[model samples]
Target: MSGTALQQVELVVRTIAQTAVDNEKYFGDLDAVVGDGDFGYSLARGFEKVLEGWDDIDRTDVGAFLKKIGMIVTSRIGGTSGPIWGTAFMKAGISAGPANELSGEQVVAMLRAATDGIKARGQSDVGDKTLLDALVPMTDAIERELASGADHAAVLAVAATTARTAAEATSELVARRGRASYTGERSRGSVDAGAMGVAVIVERISHAWTTEGAS
Candidate 1:
């Protein structure tokens, strides 16, 4: 937590890429339930590129690094996952601007910007039975915890819990966006793969924050 914002962002992005790579099959299996089954594949491939080119990534600032990642995800990844996730990093990068460090409120703002980009790119919202179902709630939880003056570690833990709970709850909701929506009421019994993926990724992020030295 004493390092520059660049260090924090690097840790998070690396954790996310590793998580996606590690859970490729699991994520694909989850997506196969109602989706075209490419969610995991697309995500893993994209993040893999991120890791593969880690040393080449821009390190001038957090914004530049994130924007570079956004470009890679959008161009390298396939399927809907590419554009949506790409837009998130792009928006977050723009929101972050040229900062070397970000406060808790600034972090929340960056997340909000990313989510907003996701909503626009995917044409979806919180109740759409998409990743937004988990992402929005997790962001909200972080905002609330920050308002209460929680530390970074505590905020991450709360965010992980909130994402998992929201993702699981999506099982009870009918899909309203993406390929899953075509399933109609039948999608109710299964959780949104994207949402659950978010939960899983967030959980890994939370764990890494505690044990990874965060530098």
Candidate 2:
């Protein structure tokens, strides 16, 4: 898949929701390992609403669809992750606007926007062992690949790898934000559930584009 290739927003939404659904228990357990067990359930509730609105979303209009998903998720899910992830989506949607086909630059811009939104909403950074940890590396990889003129497949490949690496790196650091932060140094040796979840989302997006033959 080339970065120049087109992808439908509906497909992306479906993939994200499905991934969260499949990993519901996993997320709960991860959070339960260190903090509240509601993260997964809250995320699932939000994604369920997004799934319901899937068919109605404007597939070709990336921005509108993303914005709608963000709003739906934020309203349905009752937790911190909901608003944070939703804001990220909303920011990405605003950045991409109504583009029917996204170029590499557009994709990079969306990722950057999403990261910024998450930061503003969460007040967390990479070393804090939050979603930003995964996202920062993923976006940097995407930007590097985009600058080198890599195709969608290549860009996505780098993103998945970088996200995974960042997610793993979270375990070595003590939590500095959110519920887990309350645990202080006890948060060490535990992977950040939010970081893992974000990694899954990014990896799945990459998989969807490649499997669907976006190139």
Predicted model with the maximum lDDT: 1
Off by over 4 Å in 1: none
Cα lDDT, model 1, residue 134: 94
Candidate 2 residue 85 C-alpha distance from true site, Å? 0.7
Number of the top TM-score candidate: 1
**lDDT, residue 25, candidate 1:** 96
Which 10-residue window in model 2 sums to the lowest lDDT? 1-10
Return the TM-score for each candidate structure: 0.98, 0.92
Backbone clash total for model 2 is 2
Would you list the clashing residue pairs of candidate 1? none
* Local distance difference test scores for all models: 0.92, 0.83
RMSD of each: 0.9, 2.1
